[model samples]
Target: MRLHPVVSLALTGLVALATGARAESWNSVTVSWTAPGDDGMTGVASAFDLRYSTSPITAASFGSATRWTSTPAPAAPGTTQSVTVTGLLPSTTYYFAIETADEVPNWSSISNVVSRTTSPMPDAVRPAPLTVAVTSVTDSSASLGWTAVGDDSLNGTVSSYDIRYSTSPITATSWSGATQVTGEPLPAAPGTPQSCTVRGLSREVTYFFAARAVDDAGNLSALSNVPSVTTLDSMPPGPITNLSVGFVWLGWHSSLAIRPRSAEARGR
Candidate 1:
């Protein structure tokens, strides 16, 4: 016995109502639905049509709304099927639905609709300036230290630091010529002092050093106060040993001669 047209239509509506969607992030959603029965009464669904909109989703609204199709189609009947939808706006609500179609090309009504709001995007801002100083000095290098700065409004974490130095006195207006020092490790955590050594400098030269903080988003802070440090001078050579002074008369002039003990024996 064949069922009436009205009965078959009612069953198809029930199957379509089983579909649902979930918001995964600021730009994505996951759609899922229960498989419909394989029997001709409800028909065998060979594929799924997914649609989304900022407004309430209906069969008519789907025409101009964003659309996506299920690839490889849904599995055999009674299996839970799902598909992820992406590129949606964040912090906004979106409505989604799924429509099933049989091999005979008969399309079912729109499935149950669901809505979700995505998370907001991160804030992009620069961090505050850091305080720097020279802690130690050597013949050809200097060790520097500074206090770490917090991220912009604490929206992000501190990443690293940029150290710069110059032989001339460093000031906010004259820092462009300051050479950047490399091979310095990332600064310590916020509220702590970070240290690094600058090498390959000229001995006995006075240098001005400064530093800046960087956040994870690549934001750079203002330059810190410049501290001046002078490298140590070179050591002096040893003095000669066993020296002697003698006076000699040549006519009306008297001359004094200096000689080493080892040279006196050779001269004799």
Candidate 2:
């Protein structure tokens, strides 16, 4: 069988697969068969005809199918023969067949057909990174807003959000180490305005925040834009009143207190 290099194929980056659509992949499959001879399994064949098609491939239909390229030369008659075909479509079924020829240009009959269905592609694309901003803040909590995005870059609604905050600036690399805010709402439709509030933060503390989006396929987007805010300082040093300066009579005493401040929450 003589395999040609010319084959047809198409490529597309479909991160947001439509409902019920088959997933696509970038992969290949191999086909193998025992070698046939130049003259009835007696001698090495001079050339090979290797072809594949989406439909059943037969002796008559082989010429119209896509031929595999650079097939290895036949071995001694009755030896093993194999070929790895590439550029095949993902999540597709294909049929392959072959014929053998001799130095006399005499061609043998096509071999029995073989069929294989490729695996569906994996979802490796991450959601669009969010660009979050502060919307409101109180002594113990804060609200955040950002343009909503989907599972893929502006492709479809994501499955969830991982909102995190820290006194230090947050980043994609540091996302896992930051404090995660719970009760995040399900992601909104792509391009919709979205908002969420983080609770249990300390008053009068500065906090830095960032977020990541997750897909049903478990794909995670990079961290969103980091934003910072200080919670309302409504608790501390509430107006000391009644200034009474008595003469240095009996023992006079005074006291004070302190605590580490936590920043308000921020996220996508």
Candidate 3:
């Protein structure tokens, strides 16, 4: 007796979960399909084939399309099977289909075609070098300026900057101990000079400052070179108060003597 072919193929779900993508990545999708029936014939499906491609998927496209593992037949007809497809290009649309075959080697027609686009990949590149300089200093604060760096090939714009300072040298490894400078503009424009003032500093104390750039995707760059600046002392000097002045005429030819005394001085 001639074996019957799968008469009905349908897709049950195409849930695209974000659980598999790693940091700064979006290149995965999950697909599910309902097993087709044997049209009341006496044959049962032995396996299911899943295929995908960037273009419309057809029976002829199976040879060129990316094929997933051949899943074993479901316990019974009309059952559902699911598979998670990964490592696909981000921000790209893909077409998918399913094919069922029975023990008689008769393949069913391709299932309903479905298409889905992966989420855009997150920005993974770090920003270029950021040069920080101490533009102005005072007894209680230090004004900072920096030449902003551009994003990696401008793929993503710079979101903001993380300003850090410490009494000791500032480095990438010691960033935790450094104090963060807040209130600065978030998402400073790329390739621009940004400035900010850090307050509450100690008088006559030296501080090391550094900075790093953060992209829109929250990827941070390496720490900038440590630039040191010493705050002005601005302390008042000791006061000097004294008065002592005496002048005696040395011209004795006419027997004349003169004395005058009046002296005042102040020190700060």
Which of the numbered candidates is closest to the native, going by highest TM-score?
3
Better of 1 and 2 by TM-score: 2
Alpha-carbon local distance difference test for all models: 0.69, 0.76, 0.74
lDDT of 2: 0.76
Model 2 per-residue lDDT at 177: 84
Q: lDDT value for candidate 1?
A: 0.69
Q: Which model is ahead, 2 or 3, in terms of lDDT?
A: 2
Q: What local lDDT does model 2 show for residue 204?
A: 84
Residue-wise C-alpha lDDT for candidate 3, range 169-255, written one tens digit per residue:
987789988999988766555666779899999999999998888876666788888899999989999887876799987754676
Residue 62, model 2: lDDT of 80
Task: Write model 2 residue lDDT over 50-133, tens digit each, in one string.
Answer: 888999976678899997877888787666666667676778887877777788787766777777777666677889998999
Instruction: Show the lowest summed lDDT stretch of 10 residues, model 3.
Output: 16-25
**Where does the lowest 10-residue lDDT sum fall in candidate 2?**
4-13
